[model samples]
Target: MIERDEAAIYVDGLTKTFGSGKNAVTAVEDVSFAVAPGEVIGLLGPNGAGKTTLLKSILGLVLPDEGEVRIQGSDVYDRPQQAYEHVDAMLEGARNDYWRLTVQENLRYFAAIHGQNPAVVADRHKSLLERLDLDKKADTAVRDLSRGMKQKVSLASVLAGDVSVVFLDEPTLGLDVESSLKLQQELVRLTEERGLTLVLSSHNMDVIEEICDRVVIMSGGHIVANDTVEALIADFERQGYRITVRDIDDVVLADLRERFRMTSIEQTNRKTRFEIAADSATFYRLTDVMEHHEIDIDSIETVQPDLAEAFVELTKSSESSMKPNTIEKGDGD
Candidate 1:
């Protein structure tokens, strides 16, 4: 593989399982991938698909049964503290804050630990609070803030350390539309302006599609697919085109039937409507047939599946293929 200067995280052959006997649940299996700097990679999967487990293992909160994980060229398991020196994470519940401390106090506390002096920390805190629109609430106790406000506080902790890479698990969970949009906008700004590499795990496909440059879909203890959102859409061409035509003669109708596999065909008094999944080549063939028959197209529309629908189809397909068949035990014979 060609080496890149911007790789922030590299994980290989990582595997983890819980339990010793028949109850053992394999969370991750031989997962390997790398994340580049300023790239927001979405770790997408349904619940119980090891996204959280994978994040915890990388953060050293849980030990992997096998495989290697590195952050910025340093092995997390071997270097431990040093590997995490330039890394920070914000998972569910935003547990990094002190409920008793005011927002400013919490920011100051984290900044001091990150080796910043009080004055410098305060300055940075002020700037971040202003940017995040939390300046007005800086003196409010963390315990009194709403879920969305605390999410901002959690993000503040990640920013306080000025880490190169940050991990956020379900960052927008339970947030209103306005708050979610703000968080996504801020994340994009951080990536574009500050070169922050982020690994975000969320069930929200829209969030992933909007904010992430690339996505890795995991299912049943494995990575089923990994690529850019555009590439994935183009690869499958899941969205079909719906075409309606003026009354077709016998020859034109026969031509269409022979040339393409029509997914749906409906005949009306004045027109014929059909939906089909065809690639560029197939579409060209379709056009040739239409031209030869001199058929008049009444209307045509391209339908694109939403990310949530795409994710469901992709992940569920993988899970179905991975399911093992049960074998019944024979009784006394």
Candidate 2:
């Protein structure tokens, strides 16, 4: 049996590499992090960054070549079933119900398998359907529900059971705006009211930032950033500013180019736009120079790179810096 702890999920030194020698692919490498009970963690990465592999490893769906995954306190690989007793997972397109079964029938079926009384399961099925806005479709066949409705039914199937830890892999993938918003709100409710430990993997940064308390970023099979949203954003905040001026003269433009890494500059008939990096003192010096030259300044929109942009920039830099030899090397035992 696993010991209960404040943290609901913990993965340490987890690694997974498929094949060997020439054909080997390192899917995930030395990934480690913790999700406290009642917390939501967003596993964010680009395509082929090992997000799905990490989730699969945690779910015991895929055996890792190295390291360990723990749900609550039980080692997932060691205890297997027992370790995941409290966990419930929804892969991208897993449909639990028999297609011929009605939504109500499906829930009843799963609850029965979970050892719940038929009457209680029936009540739960009704309640979940109502809560998820699936009440009208409860008697409809599983195969007939819309994609959004099917996703809801699948989620309800998991929530109806006694499981406390939920793993959602791109739960809102391809969902329309209204449906996605509803699901996102429900996910937040699960953590806030039900104290559910939710680990979500998605390519959507907005979704991740909206729901997750912490974020773990993966790139090239390695965990590049793991921290709270605020901390991660602050990590990249290195005194950047946007400057808008009434005009872009050669002297002013030359001065700016010489002082900082100017990411962008836009010149129009009435104004110029610039995204530049500079410290506080440097900002003051810049303004002082503009004033000395009788330059009229317009409004500025100082923008900082958000989590999505930061993640992209960091991973691209890391990927570009990898040596050819390293890329050529295979993942081996």
Candidate 3:
């Protein structure tokens, strides 16, 4: 076995089951992957898709029913301390500091407890405060900060440690678009300037599409797809069209629905508009059907493919291939 120290994190055949008998539910099933040094890996999946459990197993926070997980050349299950010292995690709803502490105090305090030098901690505190846009309220107690601001503080504290890897779960939740972009920019800077490796799990497709070097998508407790975002998008092109028509009465609307995949229908006083999805052949068929029925044509426009559509398609595909299964609610994701 090659010790993949060159990789920041590695896993093979990782699985987690919650119970025995008919009530047993597997949260993660036979997941395997590796994160290269300094790479940003996005863990993507819909609700109850096993993404969260996989992350916990990799982080050594959950004991796997079966499999191997290694962090920075150390076996996480065998040498917990050594495996975790180089890692920082910001799981959603987790507190990295006391409520009584101020933003500056939290950073300085956590750093010191981690055995970081006081001088280095001070330097990190100043730099992070400015970069994360928390400088103005550095002295304010964390309990007083808004939810979004507190999340920023949590992310900022991760850097206070001398770790090479960071795990962030829904880092953008509760944030406005402006603050979300700020945090995203900071994440990019960390990877670019400091060669930090990040394992990010989020439902925000925009953040995943923009920041991740590679994506791992899960469904039914299994990894349905794993590849670079660009490749995945290119391979699975979305098929969509928006069309306007004249005199779309119930008969015509029913016919259209029966023949094609109509996502939405909007009817103006005289004209009707529909957003439909189809392959090239079906798209042409739709136009021909309209012409044959003598329905007046207005215009048609193409809808470009994006990550959200790709995610939906992949999950659907995974669901179709799997056997009947029921994952436990809340615990599955």
Which candidate ranks first by lDDT, i.e. highest? 3
For model 2, give the RMSD to the true fold.
4.8
Query: Model 3, range 246-308, lDDT digits (tens) per residue?
Result: 877689889989888787899988889898767888888988998888888889898877777
Q: Candidate 1 local accuracy as lDDT?
A: 0.79
TM-score of each: 0.78, 0.79, 0.92
Higher-scoring candidate on TM-score, 1 or 3: 3
Per-model C-alpha RMSD: 7.4, 4.8, 2.2
The segments of candidate 1 whose C-alpha lies over 4 angstroms from its true place after superposition are 1-6, 241-301, 324-333
Off by over 4 Å in 3: 1-3, 263-272
Which candidate comes out best when scored by TM-score?
3
Q: Candidate 2 residues 251-301, lDDT tens each?
A: 867886887667678887878888765667877888887788788787766
Residue 155, candidate 2: C-alpha displacement in angstroms:
2.0
Candidate 2 regions off by >4 Å?
1-6, 93-97, 121-124, 238-299, 323-333
Compared with the true structure, the alpha-carbon lDDT of candidate 2 equals 0.77
Residue 91 in model 1: lDDT: 88
lDDT tens digits by residue: candidate 1, 1-333: 213234688878888877757756677788888888678899987766777778888889989999888888778878878788878888874476898999988888887776777686677679888877789999999999998888888888778866788999888876888878888888888788889889988877778888899998887767888888887776676557889999798677876887786767899997999977777788777878888888899998996755665577678788787643111111000
Q: What is the descending lDDT order?
A: 3, 1, 2
Whichever of 2 and 3 has more TM-score, that candidate is 3
Winner by lDDT between candidate 2 and candidate 1: 1
